[model samples]
Target: MPTHTPPHTPTHTRPRTPPDAPPDAPPSAPTQAPWQAHAQPDHREFDATLDVPYRASPGARRTISIYLSYPDQGRRHRASWQLELRTRKGAVLRRWHGAVTLGARPFTLQRDWDGRAAGAAPLTASGTYRLRLQARTGNTVITQEWPIALGIPPRLAMPAFRPLATGATHHVATMTPIPTGTILPSYTVYYGNLHSQTNHSDGGGDLAHCTGAQDPQSAALGPPDAYAYAQAHGLDFLMTSEHNHMYDGSDGTNPNADPRQATALYRQGLQDAIDYNAAHAGFLAIYGQEWGVIANGGHLNVFNSPELLGWERNASGQLLADTETPRSDYASLYSLMRARGWLGQFNHPAPDQFKVGATPLAYTADGDEVMVLCEVMNSSAFSHSADESESHRSNYEAVCDQLLEAGYHLAFSSDQDNHCANWGASYSNRSAVLVPGDAPLDNTSLLAALRARRVFATMDKQAQILLTANGHLMGERFANCGPLALSVRYAGAPGRTAADLTIIEGVPGRNGAVSELAHTADITFTPAPGEHFYYARLTQDDGKLLWTAPVWISQQSPSLLCAATN
Candidate 1:
């Protein structure tokens, strides 16, 4: 590849300043910093509160939001919004009143208490409170309340978005300062999604007629159309991972269907993706299999495995797809992927899913290399929206965090999982890739990014967030000693500002809840020597969120390192 300055048009990345460059400009005065100064710990007083949530969650706030849309073809819908924080006995403590909009999906908003009563009131006490959403939609008004607690563990918070502190940042792509002593990568962010279902596997319904998920093998569009839709809608790539067992035309129960025919259908889907990408420059249309059933097993996306793996067969005992891997045996599936150098993603992970030896999320060493991504958030898989205003998305953040804590080196992805023909249009959320700045937006470069865990999950299509430790980027593992500086940088389209930024820390094998470590532009501190992982969460003023991939670090003293080498 030829080296060239990464132009800003493709990615909003700025190159690093040379060390000899002038001193940094002063930062603007802080605007009511959300965090209170903490008492720095003695270097030895570490890990004492690593598992304690209260030690980490004081004064924390969750980004709560709601989005309303009208898709009735030029018709108008309206909603006015306000909020009230009330005591358990129903006395209002804080009331955030009133922002109204009279349009469609543009009604995206976020609200949180300012830690006061009105203007200059003292801070609200730390206690459980009712977060009420007071809304007036068109001709009606309604109020909804959820239990919220200040200075409480995140999982117990009300129905607000607390992007799990589960993941890390990139350096080259962020154009942000490197934490003095670390080395990180310069990557360009590419936006797209990796999971969707088309007519190829009980999806790809026609927008004109389809309502939700279609009957297996009975939709109008296929993989190629999905690619076209995604590309035309401004995505850099889209992977349509079809359900493997659905190729037999009857959701794996029609024993009379020709297994060879089923295999050919799978191949045709693959060719469709190839042909689509060949015709469309810079847009990757990936075809792969979403293998497994959600009943007794969970689904995993095999992105590079060209040969379909399945257990369903027809009356002649002929195998569907190209092979007959035993169904629901994830351990065997993971081993095969390892041997074949294939990559996969855990889709909508469940506690009872992806088991080995009947243990869910059991740490499979072979799978540690094979599965690199997990779906942290997903829109309703069968949503029929095509205008990017889908509101019914499920938060798998806790589940994805569980995967990382379970000892899997997996990054996060926000999945569209579109059963509707809308492909990438059903939602604005995306799985972003930190593709090398010098590389083209193609399948190869994108796959390389995923293989390196250079990725992040974003709920907004236009926002960017990255985390880096020292000079190391998110999704990277490196050895370090001395001071540790973790930096998080963010940017969005014009007029958007970062409202909340948090650095979350966790130990890979601790299987404990993650903790909020810091709330600053960047963090600089000396931590006790050991293995740990850190990532960031950025909530934009518009209530959108971005979760970067986490960087894992193994720290040791120089003496220990030298001894180990000897």
Candidate 2:
């Protein structure tokens, strides 16, 4: 047997061949293939293959080799190529947008991805994703995509930064309610809806789109139903943010179709929600709208506001609706929102729903009108994690982690975006804000807390955690030093002890890298250093915790560096 042992083929490496790929003509493909549409040519059939490395280590860098070969006049043209790597979530994890001149043959275009958002700052969590590619030569488009796994483990070594104080303040954080009211920042469930739907004259279908149809999740919860649901849930207040789309020219039967109709409906819906809240003693409805320029595929939101602004779209053809294509770009919409004197936030976004081409493009520019708070977690969207049902909830946390890593004013929310009216049966109202229900409810009290950005989103309604820092308290404060000073006190659902918490701080970068200041076991740092930001990662006696909004030296500082800025 030993003498007869023949040379065996090495099994470790094999010739990798790509599977069959659909043509670029599929309507749902990533994009227009970077080429203008053209009638099919009789002799032109397009096919391509790319060997992409898989199972990359977390925060690691790798390259892919794409073989481009096509039959032309019985001759084979070949070239090697590469493309950029982004977060499966479609964030520009790396911005190595590489392209090649198709006229050159057998030449490759290389893309180097550093696995960082905005092309810097190494990522923290690791996950799997797909690499989508599209190539075009005039009318000929080639599309290729492949699966990839990213596994970035936690780095044992922490970064260097000045530590901030981490402890609870004796006093509770309070906001002056509008129109003279007060609400405690303690309670279980808070409710709200995306108001653009019923408020408009045309009765827009869902918050996901402006089309008129029964909304999928929230439409079922009409006025009466919502009131009953709030009572059952022990909810003290409900918030509705409708689009200001009405122009005030038509009645309900023959609602106006003009853009003004949307604004008008928004105002009317606000009134209706307020009236209903007033009628119901325990329930209150706060007024606001998800206002944005519906141009250029961008979405921005103004949470608490009455009067809405509609901008005239210039020659560029932009609309600020939260649709796949806003008639206006980020700049126009941001400017309009800022000019109108409003506060806003970027909405829920995840990996599967929008891989860049499927929804309104994420804002990449800088501007003042960008909302100070980013909704890191929202029930409106699904997470890309293995758990599809709780993806909305899980993705919310994941988003918070990412934003914290990138140093953004990330806040958690559980909005219904309630277009259909059924209480987000599939998606959970997981992220929620706690408020005082002791006194008579008013929009001013609830909204004041929300606008101050002191809130947390949770998976379970029975769970609650409160945080504060150095006598100047906020929602949930993070204790990162000496005795890890901060409060992890909770209410409801007894039989729990020892609040499990993880605190993170955002640190600026030197070489364009985004990262957080390392967490410490004790809370001994001085509170006077007004540079770092802190937020709590609180869990119950049992391992259930919600990520609260960042409490920092200046809440508005991070907005300056936010990607949402136009």
lDDT of each: 0.67, 0.39
- Native RMSD of candidate 1 (Å): 18.5
What are the models' TM-scores?
A: 0.70, 0.51
Which tens-of-lDDT digit does each residue in 406-516 have in candidate 2?
A: 444445564444433333332434445444534333655555555666566654454544444443344433332211233233442445332334566554111122343
Q: How many backbone clashes does every candidate have?
A: 11, 73
RMSD of every candidate to native, in Å, equals 18.5, 15.4
Worst 10 residues of 1 by lDDT: 43-52
Taking all chains together, the TM-score of candidate 2 against the true structure is 0.51
Q: For residues 1-566, write the lDDT of model 1, one tens digit per residue.
A: 00011111122122221223222343564553211111111111000000001121244634555433322222344445567767645687777654333221223444443445555565446554455655564333333444444542222111111121211222234333343544444466778889988887788888776654577889888888888889889888899988887787765356576767877888888888888877878688899999887655778899988787877656565666687787778889999999999999998775556878877777788899899998877766656778887655655666677778888888888978887788889878999887765667776887788889999999887777777787777899988776778877666756766655667878777777777787665778866678888888765655466788999988776576645653
Which one is best on TM-score?
A: 1
Whole-model lDDT, model 1: 0.67
